[model samples]
Target: MNTSHQSFAYTLHDVTCLFRKHFDRRAIRYALTRAQWRALKAIRRREGMSQTELAEFLEMEAIAVGRVIDRLAAAGFVERRADPNDRRCWRLHLTSRAHAVTDDMEVLASELRREALAGVSTADFEAFERVLGKIRSNLSAIESGTEAGAEFTSS
Candidate 1:
């Protein structure tokens, strides 16, 4: 019954899929799976994080993230060492090679963003981002069983 909601859903899904395809095209050259790349980015952002912490940040299972870290270590893109304070935990660190790849991934993401916003005006984009942020906050509140948002809904 609501054409506007349908349109919003379609555009959001389409844009997300398109962005993934674009990023994959650019990222394939680095020979890293998307999971590996994401793990690398997270590790780079929070160097020396234990694998369990990284999994929580990534919202992935610890075992799955452990496998990714294993591959990354085997490829020499990352090194995992026993935590000084916690022997059972393996702290992750990106090698120089992984650092370079993550840096390039940022450049690629910037280029993709530039292309996606080629004709959008700054004001319009800022408004769009503000709306998205508001929606995100609203959903976060809902998830936490707090007050549901009524202000943004149609009358």
Candidate 2:
């Protein structure tokens, strides 16, 4: 194997670059960054999540998530309503404008996925997905303090 190609960080960086390139080409029109798009999608699905929950779901720092929400709220894409159960906590809601953007995002995501998986077989795709799941689980476990980094193998 080529030594350079064996670096996991290099592979991860390349994938990130590719994703950013495609996202720019395909999803930049909604005036939301990829992180904002993810937060919006989560808000749409959960409908009344708090900023803390949203940050946990997104695996982002609460402050970072708050900034994204701030931008979205300013853009009229999301609204923060006082939680009935907890007046101090605000629940997130997608605005009608956000719903419209979510619809476009779904289509864009589907198209991007199709393009990304062009020519890949179903079995191969399934295996790839399983590998990705394991990677995510491993990283998440490490991140949440359940396990040490020793549990993960650097590929």
Candidate 3:
């Protein structure tokens, strides 16, 4: 790879690490583990998602997601109700207690965005986003086994 590509890779890794550290620092008061916050946010985003679907979305095993759900339910941050149509599955929902914490998380995210983009110009940011989208599309195509009509399939 060229120097420029190496620099970009380094920047991405550093920025991602910094952002995670920053968020983890700010989120300590909630007493939720990183995985718990991720699960909560995912459930909050897609209320009523089955545990299996949430597991898939989180790229975790269904058993692992179930354990997270159990912990969250114990904390009163979320609840799992029996799926009306699927007796074998449970639908997850965020409890009222989680709403305020999730709201704070959103505020923290917005503040972090502002801090990160402090000096970045809108045009430059837009171009950066476009490039990122292209890269993401290429990676997704490769991951999905659909690159350049490769005639490959995977479950």
Candidate lDDT scores, in order, read 0.90, 0.87, 0.86
| Candidate 1 residue-wise lDDT, 36-155, digit = tens | 988998999899999889999999999999899999999999999889998888899999988888999999999999999999999999988988998889889989999856666554
Error of 2 at 82 (Å): 1.2
TM-score: model 2 vs. ground truth: 0.79
Model 3 lDDT per residue over 33-125, tens place: 988999989988999999889989999998998898899999999888998998987889998999889999999988988998999999989
TM-score of each: 0.93, 0.79, 0.90
Candidate 2, residues 1-155, lDDT tens digits: the string is: 45554686678789779977886688877677888989999999999999999999999999999999999999999999999988899999999999999998888878887887899999999987777677788778878988633443435
Segments of candidate 1 deviating more than 4 angstroms: 153-155
Give the worst 10-residue stretch by lDDT in candidate 1: 146-155
Clash count, one per candidate:
0, 0, 0
Candidate 1 accuracy as TM-score: 0.93
Could you say which candidate leads in TM-score? 1
> How well does candidate 3 match the true structure in TM-score terms?
0.90
C-alpha lDDT of residue 112 in model 3: 88
Query: Which whole-number lDDT from 0 to 100 does residue 50 have in model 1?
Result: 93
Q: How many backbone clashes does candidate 3 have?
A: 0
Candidate 2: where are CA atoms >4 Å away?
1-5, 140-155
